[model samples]
Target: MSKGQITKARILHQAAELFNQQGYAGSSMSDVMDVTGLKKGGIYNHFKTKDELSLAAFDYAIATLAQHHRAVLRQHHHAADRLLGIMAVFSSFIDHPPVAGGCPLMNTAIEADDAHPALKARAQQAMTNLRKLLCHIVDTGIAKGELQPAVDSDVFATILISTIEGAIMISKLYDDPVHLERAIAHLTDYIDEYLRI
Candidate 1:
């Protein structure tokens, strides 16, 4: 990569963690400067406004997460195993997170709602993509006779996403990992006993 490209990536990486942790409203230009060790002009040269940086940072974070999910999902052949793989990825966050502050989708969704329209839209799109992926997996499973044909893919996708996101939020709020652990257990059971054919 070129010098400018490297610097911009560095800025995005640092800014993503800061924004995820402190949030868009809480993080300041100085904080970005501190994190990147770049002067005002250097930062402004790459991003015209804080909003631009926030948007880019969010994309970077989400893209990183999607890459991780793809890696985990690739390991499992069956749809049920793939679904459990998703749960395992989220459960792993209790100990080691892909990003600094936890799930970017959950964090951005909570903070961006009614505050940052662009960020909120980005978060919404991310969820939509996730749900679509889950639906496809479940649908494929049913077609392959691996999952019950009567199952509603959309409902299952929504429930899985909601359960995991809720668990992440509760675990973070209560400063306890057990909440996520229980949620993961329930999700595992749901996949194996209920969804599997």
Candidate 2:
């Protein structure tokens, strides 16, 4: 990468961490400058405005998260195993998150609320992509005869994601991993008992 490319990536990464933790409205260019060791001019040279950086950082965080998902999912060929692997990946977030704050989707969704339309849309898109991934897994499982043919991929995916994301929120809230642990354990049992064929 060129010097400029490297610096821009650095800015994005640092800014992503800052924004994920502090949030868009709560964070400022000065905060980003402090974390990135870059001046206002330096930041603006790469991003036209804080909004631009905020969106870019969100994308960066999501990309990083997707990479983790790909890495873990690649190791499991069975659809059931892949779904379990996805749960494991989220379960690991308590100790080692892809980004600093939490699930970028959850964090962004909550903060974006109705205030930031652009960010709210981005979060929704990211979530939809995730749901699509789960649906794909379920569909593939059905084709492979590894899952029940009658399983509704859309509804199943929604339940899985909603359950896991809620567990993550609860775990993060009280600084307790048990909440996620219980969720993952139940999910694993549920998938094996109901989804697996």
For model 2, give the 10-residue run with minimal summed lDDT. Answer: 85-94
Per-residue C-alpha lDDT of model 1 across residues 31-54, encoded as one tens digit per residue: 999999999999999999999999
Give the alpha carbon lDDT tens digit for every residue of 62-175 in model 2.
999999889978899999999999888788889988999888888999999899999999999999999999999999999999999999999998988888889999999999
Predict model 2's lDDT versus the native. 0.93
State how far residue 8 of model 1 sits from its true place (Å): 0.8
What's the lDDT for candidate 1?
0.92
Q: Local distance difference test, per candidate?
A: 0.92, 0.93
RMSD (Cα, Å) for all candidates, in order, is: 0.8, 0.7
